[model samples]
Target: MKNTFNIHEVSNLLDVSIPKLLLWEKKNKLVPTEKDTNGINIYLKNQLVDFPIAKDVFESKWDEEIKIKPLGSYNSIELFAGAGGMALGFEKAGIHHVLLNEIDKFSCSTLRKNRPEWNVIEDDIKNLDFKKYANKVEIVTGGFPCQSFSAAGKKLGFEDTRGTLFFEFARCIKEVQPKIFVGENVKGLFHHDKGRTLQVIKDTIHELGYTLIEPRVLKAMYYKVPQKRERLFLIGIRNDLAEKNNDFKFPAPYKKVLTLTDAFKKGDLFDNDVPESIGDMYPARKKEILDFVPQGGYWKDLPDDLQREFMQRSYFLGGGKTGLARRLSMTAPSLTLVCSPSMKQTERCHPLETRPLTIRESARIQTFPDEWEFVGPKSQAYKQIGNAVPVNLAWSVARSIIDYLNKINVDNRKNTKTILQSESV
Candidate 1:
């Protein structure tokens, strides 16, 4: 078997485009071990060890499912629970849900339709009180939108975040006092507000009596999802629990980086071909222009005149504009999905067909089960699916958190036993 990878192979392995690989080389982020006779970059497996995703791909643990049972009846209350991606994953990992709050009626209905037994609350998070669930639930999780806080020269505190959704998330933590909390956000949050926003979040976590784990941005592809979506996850353990135990690690990546074929066709990720369903369609002019783009090709692939016709003013713009008039490749993972597939700035045309991906197809790419139907109009459904965290990715992270909670459970039991023995003595 070939142990070294050429530039093209490395591109496929990393889900990064060839240009991006070259860019990494230019920035000294990725160094090639050697060059082929044709002067193409060739990298040994060990040379890619610095990238966690590359390391996982080289030595995958995908053969085994991450199976972990909840040590106890661990209950969680999820806020901003749009369409239940994380909730479902947490449930699959054996965490029970006490409540799920979402502001969107369509999303709330989708959650209720799938799991009628769940306490799906369709209300503004600000209107709901989490104090009732204090001491009742072990975890509080939310995918809060990142919003900036008004600040002078002074350092921002928990109260300074009051106007943003993150404040609501922190309010729940303060009220519920869960043993652990998880916050999910777009990867951009890492650098938002020139890093000041993240600093405030870190300060708030400390104020709320929890120890925030060094946050990490997890790629969906590494976690068994067939989409190149990236999400930043923040895990915080209550101060008391943090002191009791110190070992906590993120979930390991899968062995194989799944592709569009794994998502749409019968394979390890799914049992059958993606079922047909309604999806958005491109206009005649848009469709005709995109027809010329080849598989995995974007606007640059179009003829000079046609590229000018399709791109108009954007044609003169400086950026690569890679997403415009782009077609997915059957062999690689799909690009991160946007709210609508037909948008010119980020077109998501089907691999073989000229149309946009159907409702079910989009769900599969996000690792949603076939039967896990989205209950709304095509546009609303697309929005729900596009905005969701990949279900498989959530499941992987949830398993790790559950493992940590289990360890804490054991420590608590040991401490109790010791105290009882001291009383008897």
Candidate 2:
């Protein structure tokens, strides 16, 4: 999904200075894929994939790495904890998990197998009562799946979304009323139902007496994630807490971007090169057509007749189905990973190999530590990794949350001292 653009457009699009763009070109960091009639450099989409920020393009940056440690004894509860991506990130950021709830047995097994110490509760969120943790847990977070909520009338509120998983997410917030809550979902939720879905969610959070921070789509690529994955993040502070401290800052961006090499090879992100694991195989016919599709090339790279033969009825289709028989480029960041790597609509063929990416390779793209073992069948494992928040992305956000909470804690201690002095006087 890369596109061609001029230097000036690329500079503006990436927020990099024109001089820097030229410097990159000079160093061969970016080479022109094509030259226009006027001899202006026309950059390919792949050239920009591992360096793009504020957008879908995958990129990386190196800033002062946050030295994460417990600000204090902070406790958190996670819901819909799929493969412990966000939970593990928060754990690294120094927050202790009181309990993590997930409905899927396979995912729960994965969580337990990896971290036997974690208190993982395998159950439906609707069946859980979070009231016991009210005013106890400092934070609550979830990557709650988005489900359509039908409106019987114009007054769409919490009750209107009763059966959806997001309702359970909100219900927990309403029950536990944690000091802070973070929710994540796919970026499409922003425009789902013409934006009405998010509006209803906002309204429900407000109804629970929490001050909502204007939701922002956090690109995983911008936060040390190697793939082009974007997650929409929603954070809320309890009304009282927000009133006391209205300044809650988010994490800062990295100065240098990470590349696919940083992910699979022995680099800053990992200790050693990615270990080979079992992966799905391509059918003989599919392999033959894909053999011609060069690295970074998709179905469009096939010969005209071969394309027609492979596409079948869809051979006459107008738009380019770019994902079919795709081969990834080692130099460029991987595309947004899908649950199934071999699907015709979203093929993620290995950069050099003829088959799809392995489970370890997929996990590497997700920024999960090499040691984290995913339980269950390979298919289920792929689905969980594909559906996770990038671990590094969550860690960056967690550091910000910890910093905010640290300030609040200090202020509370000072206030307590002042009140004590007054009473003594």
Candidate 3:
């Protein structure tokens, strides 16, 4: 592809809001080459191509060749490592997994089965001591569950949070003191307990002497995953490290969105068709009802009589309630995969099939390699995949984090040299 396009042309092509575009540029999320003599921002065709959304611009061609930088040799430790989704992404991003901790036997088995070299610590976080990792690992990451505090008492502090998994996460951070740490959770975390839950998390991180980035809800579609998952990312840099520089940036979104067709077919993300695997079956009546829904269609697509019958009282409800009796679309990203795709509130019927997505299909939508297998019963497999951070999305984020850390190391070396030269003088 030719490598230059002006801002206006790029804007029109990408369909992004002008203000949001400017914000992206200013925040250094996507940088333009230079301005023309007329003072209009002139972006190189390469710049437009490099834009996160540019993946869509060259979808057919680039999708086949999109490459990810391999994880280098830097070491990391993971907490709450469910089936190693984030671990695999970070591994792909080039970080070496020094150790991983998870309490679930099935998840632990999944990790060990996939990465025998990894030191899988299979036990509760509270039983482990993280002090051994102090000054040893470069990063610590976790996806601690969110829990509400008793508001009838004093403002929630570290002690008040003791019984929750998040507290264990905090304790590990306090003990390990890695140069940087990452926390991931559901997007609903932002509004949990009217925002106080998030506030407490921030305060806890600050108390542990880290500089917290303003957390963001990164959409999976923006990162090339064929599922519409949203994750809240919490990044913290040790206060001492942040004092040295402030140019960290998040990963750029992929240019193109992926669809179910891109996921199951031979494509950049996978080499061949998804592997055949065991999957959940719908009841006979449920199957009959879902059969009426068209590809990319939902309950509303059913004949009015059937809709009224299936929806029953919910039919009279005020909102789209679209997720109910929903079938997926091949063209659009799949709805967020839940532990149970057949649940009343979160149906994820296949675009064409009458039943819910198969376990392999769920894995593909989350960007797992075709060879990766889940080590559990089918239902447990669904749960593991549903709870995972999309591997590609995590890879994108990990790449940005690595880039930031490398920059920090370089700046530190430069500063050290300057100090030594000054002293000699």
Question: Model 2, poorest ten-residue lDDT window?
Answer: 54-63
- CA deviation > 4 Å runs, candidate 2: 1-65
Q: Can you give the TM-score per candidate against the true fold?
A: 0.91, 0.86, 0.84
Q: What is candidate 1's lDDT per residue for 48-150, written digit by digit as tens? A: 7677768777676544447678888999999999988999888888899999999999999999999999999999999998888888889999999998888
**lDDT for 96 (candidate 1):** 94
For residues 115-205, could you state the per-residue lDDT of candidate 2 as single tens digits?
9999999998888998899889999999888877787246778887788888999999988888899999999999888887888888888
Q: Which one is best on lDDT?
A: 1
Better of 2 and 3 by TM-score: 2
lDDT of 3 by residue, 35-111 (tens): 88887777775555555456555553323223534333578989999988899999887889888999999999999
| lDDT head-to-head 1 vs 2, winner | 1
Better of 1 and 2 by TM-score: 1
Q: Please list all clashing residue pairs in model 2, or write none if there are none.
A: 60-256, 60-257, 60-258, 61-256, 61-257, 62-256
Local error of candidate 3 at 385, Å?
0.4
